[model samples]
Target: MNRTPESLTAALDAAMATLDEAVAGGKARLTPEEIGHITYIGKGIALIDGLPGVRSEELLMLGDGVQGLVFNIDPEQVGVILLGDYGALGAGDLVRRSGEVLAVPVGEDLLGRVVDPLGRPRDSRGEPVCHERLPVERPAAEVMDRAPVTVPLATGIKVIDALIPIGRGQRELILGDRQTGKSAIAIDTIVNQRGKDVVCIYCAIGQRSSSIARVIEQLQRHGALDYTLVVVAEGDDPPGLQYIAPYAATSMGEFFMEQGRDVLVVYDDLTQHARAYRELSLLLRRPPGREAFPGDIFYLHSRLLERSTHLRPERGGGSLTALPIIETEAQNLSAYIPTNLISITDGQIYLSPQLFQKGLLPPVEVGKSVSRVGGKTQLPAYRAVASDLKLSYAQFEELEIFSRFGTRLDDETRRTLERGRKVRGILKQPQLSPLSPAEQVMVLYAVTQGLFDAVPEPELSQAEAAVVAALGILPDIVRTIEQGETLKPEALEALLAAARKAVSPLLGPEKVADDH
Candidate 1:
């Protein structure tokens, strides 16, 4: 089967001809790139004097892999937002146009890790092994591609689940002053997604390292870190990094959401984000608006939050829920940043400093806190039990305020006041402790059935705990609620009777009495 020498030479000649043609084709194509120069550099921003073809939002590269985004295009120079170490860059340093937008790495390997705005690992681990890169900014899903938010996003906090529920893709703002347990709600929500198929992203912009460490410890303790990603731009980081942290984190979460998985992203507090933007804007010489913030401050937040939504089934039926936190000074909700966020978000959970000082754990100001979309997404079981709960609580609060004026209350008024006290007590939950839907339903049923009537306010927590334990052991009521069954009058009466029978013994005869 040996081939002739002349035939072999012919085949070799054909292979060489193909190779020469490919090289000629490669040489015919154009490979063009523009280079710029740093005219001036300071404060995490650089002025580029060339790259006339550079477009706004385009990325530029410097020596040693440093990157910058074209922020402000000017006649003489383009203001570039530095995304890396700008201290090493100086005037006349060569800068080449990347011809791409700033992007971050996103992948499953990022879970259970802490990273910077650039998607680099901050957990002291080696570099993250991500294969996909997404731009920091992306357009929101079109209206036709989005679905109505009809699914519940459980936070596991009794008060929130019962009253201010959050939907799967809604943007619910957590607004309050410092030490109002804002981050606690976010962390508890993450912990609640333990078995639920929800991916969580926590963006800590301009936060202390100690605070971030504590949050990581909490997640690891509860095993939530297995499905959660933490993006940090510490207080010591450049304002530019802080400004882009939430957006970068959003891109990471968006990656999962596009894969038809639900995602929950918490911007730990946007106050710091706004401040960072303000600093960067001023450094870039943008005009200041109210409170010295840039005029585009509203756009800054709306664009980020708008990225969170429920995709239609045609678009994979996934969702991204945003819990954006904003800090206010002296409880001023009308502040520029708070107001802007409140308008952009679906609703807000306003934590009251007054209630905090009074020893309420979450201190959620029910009067001010509202969930516009959650009402539609609330479980039918919860809706049946808590339909009148908020109204009754409001009435009780008004009556209590009036009673504080030294007026004697009638039996009905006094009864309302006592029930409200018990309700408040039941809602007081410890940080990091999350309740399941069934546990929440059982406790609310007990309250509605007057099971806590005899328990003193000081012992209400003990009563609720007993009720929770009884439900776990009895299993019937929890099973019904977990199955999403409707709790009718007759059915609730039976469940309450069984619950009372099981819980009263745990509360002891001294604390149990006939309310009728």
Candidate 2:
């Protein structure tokens, strides 16, 4: 032992091996689990053989930490849907079973972050340090464990809140043609959630990156990003990602809902989600049904949307409201997907191109849009002002349509048309400018009281602005409506007096008195 470099290295190696054997009790030989080799790969899918124990929906490791999900299993082989780059995969590649289902990181830290379906940060920020992981597929709360959807989720859109009030835990479908302000409604709803104690998750499936960027910018500009999480599976991503994006977003929102917090999740558009599912299913060789879609297409959405619910008090009393958007071709509601979602959701808000083209903005077709749960969840103040609005508007529309055909109109009909025009004006809200409860009440009360009847159509906007300003003079009216949830007769009288005072200068005293 002359202590040469070679001799010292040999001695050190021997000593280290002896220490490891001693620490391991001579049982240091570790046996690896069974591994499968890919036999075929294409179309974001692969077939693996040699792993007999792989289960459906189980995670598979395909080298370099890349993973896939076991989509189909057979005695001979298992079909896997690649969640990462498939171009790098080749035949004979070893894929190991992870023995776990796919999950996403979830926690409070996920708020204000942009991520993918796998919980990886997409905002160019590093990975989020989340303490908990949740499975993307979880059964919804049971009936007994769920509570009634009585609490209102104010969207701050006058038309929606006044006529189609969405309740907590409700699944309201926002269906319309492309570029018809469907996403606008969802974004505005998220923007309105600021300071409302509601967490928001916006999932973009198969949308353009530019579009997603614009949405992010809008939320940031409005300070809504603080309470929102954005999950994006853009148009260029694999279909598997688009398929899983909504479910992953739902899981993230579920974390908050379980903590007794209210949440709102928007599937920017499920039409693309459905298409992604169809692509995946067809690639997996599944039998096709209507429109070449998989037979389980309905099940795909039902399972995901069912997760949105309100838990009973014993189960934390939290709620998850779902606003799933669907795009139709040429405003055809008879399409298969639209009809499926319509049947699955509590009710739908139908956006009409005809109305949209007329510069009606949101273009929520009153006759076509119905919220089965919203009316019941409306605040008392709103209910009182809006109870007769829909009917009156419907009558006005009918008369207006007839009047358009050169039909004769009586004095009563003319009065009704004037009232309806004011109603429509009051409901036409600007983008990103959601109305407060007080403003809604003031505007609606004015329309109901015929205060704006004398104010011509061209001056409705200005008159409304003046009334809203005057409403500020009486903070008690707004506070009482918010707190007591109802407007007393005395409160209405005072509101009327205030409105007269507010509009006297704007509308001229003679017109104000004549209208009064």
Candidate 3:
């Protein structure tokens, strides 16, 4: 029954008197809807004594506009929370529906604003124009189709770009220390997608208000917020909101992907998100495990991150690229949370704070990261560069380190060191710094060719140009090769032959050899 002001007022007076009596006399009984109604006032919810349909004594939350989240809703007797204390809640709040759902805005006006889980603008910009609304409540996962990831998502991080590349529908985890640039990398990737036909959803759960604000400002400055959706659940929000923030963002991303638009969904950090679930679990009397987290922590991450996938071609042919960030304490990645995430993702871009301080923006440790699904999305030119880049770096690194102590190094090792240095220099961009696709391909070629070796003194522009000029010639060479495969050695050789003649004067007479 819909409530008018007078009727709701009468009902409230009666309920308030009853609740006061219960608080004073120590006894009260009510039905689930009544309990749902009462929980908006503040006692944490749970399955109470012998309640027929009580799901759990979880907290109930209702924002000003939408339907509230009530866990155990019983239609009988209106189960009531007598002394409920909804912090900052007014007595005038009415229960809408007993559903834990929210709406998604579909209009273009939201292009530049940062929003929270409730879809409220956090950017201080203005209200977002709504086009469509969606229910936050999800049905069971049985009917959903499972699909593999095959589309490329250019994060523009070197180690990740070369070794641990992510496909359109891939779930790529970024695990690292507090100051290791995890969130920055995710944000940069989102910003980089501005001109591309991609939508970005950034979910910030249990993050500091200041940090969240900074992210919003960063997105706004870069104009990435225009094409991105920001879903924030701050550190002070109820645990329930933290648990649902990512889901709300993912739903928004899925909506676009279904319409044949690509979506990049970044879970700013899931470590706190998982902890929030564990907090609620413990509060509800669930048993804890090795890390004092609920046993289902792994499953929660798996299910959430797995939601990013290239839907089967028959299903609109769009994709959701997932980049889930995990914060590891003291850089101990062996912790239960990091391990659980590592197992669930296709690959991880492990950022080291030590490297970040050493001036590496992405700080991605190539040796520590590996993409298991490499064959799925790597283009021929990219794959060719990646395949040999690692070996060269390793060979160069060993020689360079020893040579620092005055040891003589082999020519091959010296060349590798120069290449490695150029690679490192190129990767050292600022946090949340995004590079263009053309820029990525250009530098990629610089590494492939030993351009670093011939530079008596490497100028940034020179290195950048050498790379762009190399990549400018790839389309003509790989025109006949199939997508998702590396360019053939013979094809590459022909390109390199012309490249040598073209660059001999500009880069000088350095021997460029073909890998046989």
Best by lDDT: 2
lDDT by residue for model 3 (88-153), tens? 454444433333334456555655557766577776667878878665544322325546666678
Please provide TM-scores, in order, for all candidate models, with all chains considered together. 0.93, 0.94, 0.76
Off by over 4 Å in 3: 1-51, 54-85, 88-111, 123-132, 137-144, 398-412, 430-439, 456-462, 469-516
Best by TM-score: 2
Q: Rate the local accuracy (lDDT) of all candidates.
A: 0.89, 0.89, 0.67
Error of 1 at 154 (Å): 0.8
**Alpha-carbon lDDT of model 1:** 0.89
- Model 1 residue 410 CA deviation in Å: 2.0
lDDT of 2: 0.89
Single out the weakest 10-residue window by summed lDDT for candidate 1: 507-516
In terms of lDDT, the poorest run of 10 residues in model 2 is 507-516
Model 3 lDDT, residue 512, Cα: 34
- Residue 101 CA displacement from its true place in model 2, Å: 0.3
